[model samples]
Target: MQHLLGLYRASERDIALILQEAAVLKPALLSSPPQSFSFLNGKTVVLAFFENSTRTRTSFELAVRRLGGSILNFSAATSSLQKGETLLDTIANIEAMQVDAFVIRHGESGAAEIVAKHTRKVVINAGDGMHEHPTQALLDMFTLHETFGRLSGLHILILGDILHSRVARSNIFGLRKMRASVSVCAPPTLLPVGIEHFGVKVFADISQALEQCDAAIVLRLQLEREAAGFIPTLREYNTFFALTDEALSKVSHKIFVLHPGPVNREIELSSVVTDRDDTSGKSESLILRQVTNGVAVRMAVLKVLLYDRA
Candidate 1:
């Protein structure tokens, strides 16, 4: 198989096969964890993050370690990247280190594709601007697979910041590829042009989008867009797009809530819903499960792309 650059770029059969593999591997990874990786054990994975992230960075690091591989961290502030070293030159130096994988996050669109073209090592798109967050979509599909037992015909609603959310773009592709129906719920300003072309239904109102959906993935309102002139104010966006408990109550009982991390509580999601444990009080929230599944799904990705002898 070729490198997985975007979820929608994958064939339907391939997506189904990965989903099936994830189902079988999730229990194995969670129970009898591998001491390290069988194939990646001595391999070095480079984490080149040019943007801010807590979940994607930490999850990738944990996934590498759990697979028995090591990582070399690279941040722009402490590296030659700050001194104007080109992305190509940096990747070349890292490639010379015999790295096995390059998990990259950059603020520019198509940055990962550029690195994929220039580098000899495997390139995983952690995120590249508003272009795509392929792994996030993978983990989300994992989470849904775990919770719902299937992907085809599932109704998923993605809420907020669609104009600048790599998550939305990737999920649109990932979900559609898996034969799921997808909808984007956001204010007009927060949505990008030509969203319908991606094969997702669009909703200008959050309440309408939530109606009878199987799951809802809420995206935090990206403040950076304000500077980029994509949006005007947090106050207005919150008033319109924020997913309060009140908003969640409007959705069907079967609809599960999901969010990618650094959740702006009361901004993108209600703390009451996201922060709450189940009846046990000690049980983990779905957000925590999302994080946990991130590692396993990434491990599956690494194993399939880097190790599978097929």
Candidate 2:
């Protein structure tokens, strides 16, 4: 077992095994009193998120706690990182305390890899700028597994800001590894110059990409990454790639929608689409389910990394 620093370093078999493990573990997680794994009984995890994160941070902390591990949370503003502390120095201080794992998210590309290179402790990249989000990709695979019972042969459309989305990059690799058909839909300006090298079809029109997809994932449009002249307005981007209810209806009826959140609401999707209850009406929403799956996926990741099974 080793640190999951990036999706490119992971093999197709590795992706399959984690998805399989998550499926088995998810049932136990929902049981009344909850099933627990004792593999982490005496371990300590340090969550070092340099960037602000609501779901990834909280869910990972919860996951570690549930596995009987303790966690230390550190934010950039509250720590010496704000004072120009090197990533090595910051991790070294934590490593001195015998931390078993460092779950990190930073705003610079390759920041997690640098920490991993310098630290003795296992490193998991929660995210690294626009590089990758391996855990998010795993959780997404878990969600797809639950829905389609298989990852292969499913047409998945990744829409919106592909140029700056670590989520899209991670999903493309993980999905490709699992033999799923993946496509990207975004305005030309919002896509990377040579992303087709990843082997996914690129589409400028959302409707054309959605027509044959079994699932569609909307990457959160990162306003912070937008340059002054990137686009004229958010409304213009939405008009082209946002998955409104009408837009969703144009896709296959079997399509399931996904978003890595802090959703931009009407900007990425209409309120009616996000608000509609499925026929069952019992499930609160898909967003929360994605959040929950994140914990399970990360748990599987931690277990595999530390327990030497994956």
Candidate 3:
């Protein structure tokens, strides 16, 4: 509970508590007048993003301001890392400057763990390379719970790029912790070795996978990881694997579609489903709702971590 490193290390009770706190904070923080709570009033958080991001970075920034906190946006490119300074040295320097916590996204797996161990300050992993994005998984669960009223017994299918997805790994950990049945569908190349040991069913056919699940978390094809010949070709992967409207038609019940975005409009899902006018903020895709909940969830997490709740 002291550090939000990864959901796999967190208890079911802890996840439930954070989600509960988010539910309470969401209404006021997202209201028309947008009430701001000052629980984090004097704390300073550093967004130590070593990798580029859109949703995760922006939402954390939004959450920090909404909670009346201060944030410093850190860039590895501009920092001493470019000048041969070590990560530990950089963190030591930042911690000396009134920083209370760090929300870090790094390109290496276990990088957050290294920082969490190095500093006494709270560490929240924004993301770690192909390891786990705990907050993204938490927010995805938050969106699902908002729509379904619960996580238990709801069969969720996580489709795509499993072997390289930190989001997928975290989701599998979290959803299973909440008592929800988790399954994955991906090309055999994209699926990880011994994934079933994590307590999930695996499927090859996307249609059959769609038939059994109530909701599907569509993952973007991690094109960055494709250089190692994980698949035959990107075109072949998209043609056969992408979650399209035609694929959803085979299922009878509504299969809520979600993607921890920067959605690949061309490869992961068709534009028709993602291109809908959702200005009312009630998109059935639940994509936009996930973004909104991210701020609330991060706010709840910051409140818990920085409030001396240990």
Candidate lDDT values, in order: 0.79, 0.82, 0.89
Candidate 1 vs candidate 3: which has greater TM-score? 3
Any residue pairs clashing in model 1, and if so which?
36-67, 36-68, 37-67, 37-68
In order of lDDT, best first, we have 3, 2, 1
Q: Evaluate residue 23 in candidate 1 and report its C-alpha lDDT on the 0 to 100 scale.
A: 64
Per-residue lDDT of model 2, residues 151-264, tens digit only? 889998898888889999999998998899999988888889998999999987777887867777877876754456677788787777788866765654545778889888
Show how many residue pairs clash in every candidate, following the order shown.
4, 0, 0
- Spell out the clash pairs found in candidate 3: none
Please give, for residues 3-105, the per-residue lDDT of candidate 1 as tens digits. Answer: 6677757777666666666566567566664445555787888889999888889888877777678889998778988898999998998789788888989
Candidate 1: what lDDT? Answer: 0.79
Residue 187 accuracy (lDDT) in model 1: 75
TM-score computed on alpha carbons, candidate 1? 0.90
lDDT of 3 by residue, 68-151 (tens): 999899988888999999999999999999789999999999999999999999999999999999999999999999999999
| Lowest lDDT block of 10, candidate 2 | 279-288
lDDT winner between 2 and 3, please give it: 3
Best by lDDT: 3
Question: Candidate 3: global Cα-lDDT?
Answer: 0.89
Which candidate tops TM-score? Answer: 3
